[model samples]
Target: MNDVTSGPDTPPLTKALKETAHRLGADLVSVAPADRWSEPPSFDTSTVHVYPHSGYTPSELMPSTHSVVVVAVRHLDGVIDSTTTDTKTTAIQGNFGYVLLNRKLNDITFGLAHWLEEQGYRSVPLGSAGQSRYNHRADDDPDILSVGYGVFSLKRAAVLAGLGRKAKNGVVASPELGVRMRLGALLTVARLESGPLLEGDPCPPDCTICMKACPTRAISLGGRVSHLRCFTDVGRRGVRYEEIKAKFKAQYPVDLPDVDYVDKEYWGNEGTGNRMCKIACVAFCPLGKRRLPDVMRRVKEFEQQRPKVELLSFPPSHEFALDAVGEGNSAAEPSGSG
Candidate 1:
């Protein structure tokens, strides 16, 4: 978080910042030049609108943003894979799990921003939650094309920051964690050396696990994601919860006036049945096969007492996790002399 400008001392300072990020609970961290935003987005953004306003750029977001720091937090080993019909277990994995994890990740980014400001550099922290608003649609076609509202693309920023690559499922795939991680970003005025993008594809060309596992056929073999389909399927519970709430309000205008109507299916009950939504694509990926045994063991233990939801299928590993990337780690290392 040093307020050093672009110079010979910048690299060491960048290394220190990365080390600080790790110490702040980030599983992975990388720095990208603000200029990376200049390139056209991989996904079609022509129809999308960034929040607070559209047309906001890296320069506009921080005016003097010279670098963007991207960070990732690994999901607990068995959390995502432990599917269960038990409302409590499902709620833990589906609804509240991501909400809690995202909050933690956002806090980490805010901490980094605070540290940067303490060092005399201004920073803007982008939280892991509430980034998506809606799907942008063309007036003529009436079909959703891209995100209608957002600030910045965390997945894209993560890629440019050398944290990971994009999988066919439209999620960022980390070399160490596959798609089992959430991302957060910070834009700063500090001029730090940029990290290179991680080499190689985390998703194999022949592997279509995510595409096959998607219940809505939202993912394609060519890497295109149907935003509409994906959102509709995942948001089913939320939609139904809203409908039920409306009905209850209409029928019981005066009963339990102060009590809030809760949806156990959507949010779970007292954290015992909090289910978010299914993430079959994420769970079925072969990249994290090494963690599968542990995941299954936990699933067995949980299902022994309660029936767990069944998965579509868990495929065998097509390649070792190491084989997805080059031999050396692309992550930023701490400077020995810093």
Candidate 2:
């Protein structure tokens, strides 16, 4: 697979499509085979109760779905850092990584899907963009046709795509971008090359910053998150750090755990509105906090504070991201990321 055979192995079309994704501003691009979704989802019902929206498999949506292409792009920095505050206007007020980023990601998938179709492969873009393009009648809803369909879950698709591991915060945390990212997908019959799953834990051992920082206490230690609390509470009322801080202090431990508060970036100007969650999980997480060197330094610090769990670096960095994909003996692209 690493040899780039481009015929029955690497496939030139796969490489070309990946390059196209990069050119479209995608930070990471990976693929997952259709069979992956066909398998029964395996997870502990006791600790993990999340049933991602719909349960439809890729094959059910598109019978000939040979591969699923997943792509991720970063939001403007500082959105995650704003988790300490109740209001996060930095992202809502027309920031590149907010609504605009989602739209752009949709565009990328739509374009890729169109490209796949041109190559005689059927593809369906998964996102909210223009529905009219795929609909024959104006009253028709592309909900299951053109919109984000065919995948069981986008986050899981991202994990399968080999971009990164799913973090404790419930979002797919990329080594390069952390949780402050927008993900998009395209279901295609084309068997594009895939990447490997990122190895190791994204969070440093003993570092439960995200679970601890959650304003609503929605995230559990066992990784079960209350999506209702996160979306409803945070979106409707906003997240206030003082509330989270007070709760933590009330349940004080031998020594108060160190909680880092980062400055919220207001690229769209400060105090826009307190509509969304400040994204506390992303704010305190050490991953993607800085460049690789800076992130490594923090990991070393964590290793000292908590010696039980070993701390390490997130692999498939920019230097090796391209190479990481298509590395295994199966396809030119990675089976997962790192």
Best by TM-score: 1
User: By how many angstroms RMSD does model 2 differ from the true structure?
Assistant: 16.2
Candidate lDDT scores, in order, read 0.57, 0.52
Q: What is the Cα-based lDDT of residue 101 in candidate 1?
A: 66
Model 1: how far is 90 from its true place, Å? 2.8
lDDT of 1 by residue, 6-59 (tens): 667787778888888999899888888887677454333433211122324677
lDDT of 2 by residue, 97-179 (tens): 45677677788898888877776778888752211111122113212211121224677677766777767666777878777
Model 1 misplacement above 4 A: 1-4, 40-55, 84-89, 147-149, 234-277, 288-290, 293-338
- lDDT of model number 2: 0.52
TM-score of each: 0.67, 0.60
Mind sharing the TM-score for model 1?
Answer: 0.67
As a TM-score, model 2 comes out at: 0.60
RMSD of each: 11.6, 16.2
Candidate 1 worst ten-residue window by lDDT: 313-322
